[model samples]
Structures are given as structure tokens and as C-alpha cells.
Target: EGIFELEYLDLEIGRCRILEPVKVKMVVAKTKEGFTVGGFVKTALEHPCTRCLKPVRLEINGVVEALYLPKNLASFKREKRLETLKNVIYYTGNIVDLSERIIEAIVVEIPQKVLCKPDCKGLCPYCGIDLNEHPDHVCDKISQESDIDPRFSVLMNLKKNEEEG
Candidate 1:
């Protein structure tokens, strides 16, 4: 087991930046076919909230698992190694690069919807004022009106009747 420091890697997440070096702990096992590496990674990233546009810092934790085989294995049985096992990396010589697989592991752990807080009120659609800062701020024209299109009023009435009943 060892701690690996991942530095200055670009993840291409929208408006997001890695806050620090990724902390990773890994263990390697030798298999008859190849090598198996498994580990966990932890880090934090900062991005704008999807709703409020406030800077949101989120802690990200992910797992890393990969299989590595010698480059010569790819030619076995007419390139059969490439088709059989999923996510197998063939490496030449003694060096194995884990950077790409590490990035993939982190990408899957990222939340689809990033929010500053669970109860973030977000920005007002009419005036663009941050609703979290002023929960009671109501637009004169917006409060008394339903912004839903008239074509969807039938669906709205159905919801209202369902709630009342």
C-alpha cells in the first residue's frame, strides 16, 4: 500500500477546479493473467452552484480499479485480449501509467447537479437577485401571476385537484 499524490490534473468539469492534490491509497496484486490494482481517491473541487451561481466546494471521493497486462498479450489469439476483458490496459516494459484510469474514476463520482446547499433558494428568474440573500424578496409582477403557459393549465388543474382530494 502507498499514498500517491496526483498534481495539477485537468478534469474538464464545468467551471470546476481541483482544490488540492488528490490523495490515493492503492494495493497491487499479481494475477496469473496480469496485475490487479485497486484503490480509493479523495479530493475536493470548487464550482458554481447550478441554481444560485454561488461558489460551491464539494468533497469528492472515488474508487480506482484496473487490470494491466503485457503489450504482447494483445496479439494472443488474433487480438483476443482487447475484446474479452473490459478496461484492460496493455503496457510495454515495467512502467504502468495510472493517470487516465484515475481520472475516469473521479469523473464517475462527480454529482450531476452541483448545489451550494440543499436549501439554496437560487436566483430570481425575473430580476436575477439571489433569492438566498433575500428570502422574502418578491417581485410585484411575478408574485401575483402564474408563469406557466396556458396550454399546461389543464395539467396544473389536475395537480391542484389531486392535492385537494
Candidate 2:
């Protein structure tokens, strides 16, 4: 059993970044073949909202569970790598680093559509201002009444020629 503090900068998870040191508590149980580790990691992440583009702070609490196999045992059988443990993570030395596995667990849990709130007003296409901030925001109205579909261009030209003739 052990506690470790991981402080890293510029660690990017998707488009998010860890703003501080991550706390991890782990317990290792020795097995005949290898060792199994179970723990939890806690940290904070900053990411831009997918809709509003506003910076959103997210609290990450992820459970970490991984199996470590020695180099010889890991390399002896290639099939065992996948068949033995579905979530087995390989390590070389006596020290098993669960950082990579922990990171993977957290990243996978992040949702594809990360919005700041359930109802987020996105930015305006013309002025690029946040619509949420200015509910009454309006842009120059460009009329598309005279615009003709390109697919009907030939018919439009023939009608124009007939009217002019």
C-alpha cells in the first residue's frame, strides 16, 4: 500500500489540461504470475466547453486497476498478454507505474459532448460573441431572397432570356 503525488505540466488529455498535482492511493497484491494493483486517482482538469467554448473546470475521480507482468513472463507468451487479463498493463522493472493506466481510465470517462451546462448558448457565427452573455445580440441581416439555387441556374437563365426577348 502506498500513496504518490504526481505533479506534471503540459499534460494534455484530449483538449483538457491537468491544473495541479494528482493524488493516487494504491494497494498491490502479489500473485504467482504477477502483481495486481487497485487504486483511485483524484485531480482537476480544465477544458473548453464543446458548445460555448468557455473554459470549464472538471473534477476527475477515477478508479485504477491494472495487472503487472514481469518482462520474461510477458514476453514468453504473446497470447497470454490479451487472454489472461483483459485490463492487464505491462511493466518492465520491479516498480510498476500505474500513471498511464490511470490516465487512460480518466480520459475514457470524459464525455464526447463536453458542455459547460445543459443549455449552453453557443457563439454567434458572424460576430463571434457568446450568445449566452448577450441574449439580445443581433447581427446585420443579410437577405437571401434574391439568391437562386445553383442546381436550377440553367432554368433561371432561360426564364430571364424569355422575359427579355
Candidate 3:
């Protein structure tokens, strides 16, 4: 079943189809001036979070629109052409392949980084352990004595002598 529907005056040039159920919505329209088409896409696919290696869900949504104009008028001069064309797609033939356009919109909407949750407790760097499940884990702690470097021992002795004096 299609996630969205398109009521087209001419079904020959345009039609609607759902690539992935509940994830993608495709619409195609054939106009006298040209062909206009668009789609709404979404994905809840699992991916590893950059901060934590835990699995996270990603959701994407976007709209893709295109227009098919006559080949002769393809080079029509218009201010802010690229920006205008971004919202209005151009085509030179009767049929426009909207697969790439729709996919591109969806791809751009995808998040660069996926987080498992807002406050995900990342893994412990020292022990290489997942901190989310083990809030009380203390194996990664460093002893106060062990944390002191030998180079600071001289400084500590000098400070002690000054205090005693």
C-alpha cells in the first residue's frame, strides 16, 4: 500500500507509488507546461551512534519537486536560477525519472550523526566498558596515590619544607 496518494489528471506521465511501506511517499503530476513530481520519505533504520557504539534509530523526511519544460526553453534566463530550479525541477522529455531526485532529498535529510538517546552514557574509555547499563561501575577509577607522577614528588617535598619553616 502507498503511504501517500496522488490524484493526477493524466496518469500516463505521472503516478504514485510507495517504495517502502510507511517510509516513502511518491507523487507524480503531468502538467501542460511540464511534469511536476515530488515525494515524502522517511527511514527509522538502526545505526551505531558516533559517541556510543549502541544502536540508534534515524528518521528522515523531505519533499522532492520537479518540472519538465520544453527542450528549447530549457535555457530560459531567470534571476536566482539555481535556487528557483531547486524547488522547481526541469525536464526535457515527456517522462521524468524521479527516482534519483526523491532519493537525493531523503539522503540530504538524513542526520550526519545518530545518537542512541539525548543523554546516552557512553562507554568507559579506560576499561572499554558500556557505562549506560552499569552506572555503579568503578573499575575505571584511578587511585589518588597512583595518579601522582614521580616528577611532581620534588615539588611536593619543596612545598612541605616551606610550610614547616
Candidate 4:
């Protein structure tokens, strides 16, 4: 039962940025295999919105869990089992390294799709203008052209079914 505040963590995920200190609370217990570490992690991440390209800050809370195995066990049958498992780390010395486990915990909690707002209008396809700011925006070229795509023109007559008459 301990609390640790990490100023920053070295991670690269596109335009994502860690906006606040990473706070971790973990409990380590000695197990037959080695050690079991479980904790909670909290942090804030800033990422560009998917549609509008706006910076959006989101709070992340993740649960950390991992199994630490000794290097001596690597030579035996247990090593083969470790390869198929998730959140497992092999260590040699007395000091256990938790960096890899901590990063994994945080990453799993990150959201796949992030948006500034629920109904973000996004950008106009033709002009690349932020639609949220200008909802009524219209492109003259698109309006002048035929609304239907030529490739799908044959499907238009399927609705009338002239042969039925």
C-alpha cells in the first residue's frame, strides 16, 4: 500500500501528451511463482479530436496487475507458459522493475475514439472548414454537380421497376 507520483513517463503515442503527474498506488505480495503487483493509476492525457483536429484532454484511470517471475525460472518449464500470458515480466535482481507493468495498465484504459463534443460537426469535406463554427456552410462546386455518383447510376432505376407494368 504505497502512493507514487511520477512527473512524467516516457511514452510515444502519436500526438498524445501526458498533462499531469502519473499517480500509482500498488500492493506487492510474494507468491509461489514470484510476486503479484496490483494497483490503480490515474493521469490526464491530451489528444487531438478525431474529426475536427482540436486538442481534447481526457482523464484516465486504470487498474494495474502483473506477475513478476525470477530469471532462474526462465530456464525451466515456467518460461514457456510466461510467453502466452499477459502482463508478465522477468527480473534478475532483488529490485523488481515495474515500469513495463505500469505503462501497460495505463495504455489499456485509454479510449479508442475521443471527441471534443458529442455532436461535433467536424470539417466540411470540400472546403475543410470547421463545420461546428459555421453550420450553414456550403460548397458551390458540389451543389452544381450531379448529386448521384455515376458509378451507382444503374441502381436508380431499381426503385421504379418498369417491367412490372
Identify the leading candidate in terms of lDDT.
Answer: 1
* Candidate 3 Cα deviation (angstroms), residue 10: 34
Q: Model 1: per-residue lDDT, tens digit, 1-165?
A: 444565444545454677867787788899887798899988876777889988787787889888888888777773565466677888898888887777777778877888889998899998899999999998765644387678978987898799999
Worst 10 residues of 2 by lDDT: 2-11
TM-score of each: 0.65, 0.69, 0.53, 0.71
- For TM-score, the strongest prediction is 4
Q: Write the per-residue lDDT of candidate 2 for residues 83-111, one digit (tens) a residue.
A: 86678766676676676777866676566
Candidate 2 local Cα displacement, residue 116, angstroms: 1.3
List residue ranges in candidate 1 displaced over 4 A. Answer: 1-15, 75-86, 138-165
The lDDT ranking, best first, is: 1, 4, 2, 3
Cα lDDT of model 3 by residue, 108-164, tens digit: 665675568878878876676777888787763533446558888787789779999
**Residue pairs of candidate 4 with colliding backbone atoms:** none
> RMSD to the native, candidate 3?
10.3
Better of 1 and 3 by TM-score: 1
What is the per-residue lDDT of model 4 for residues 18-119, given as tens digits with 9 covering 90 to 100?
Answer: 788777889999988899889998888777787887889888888988888887776787556677778777788889767666677777776777789989
Better by TM-score, candidate 4 or 3: 4
Assess candidate 1 and give its TM-score to the true structure: 0.65
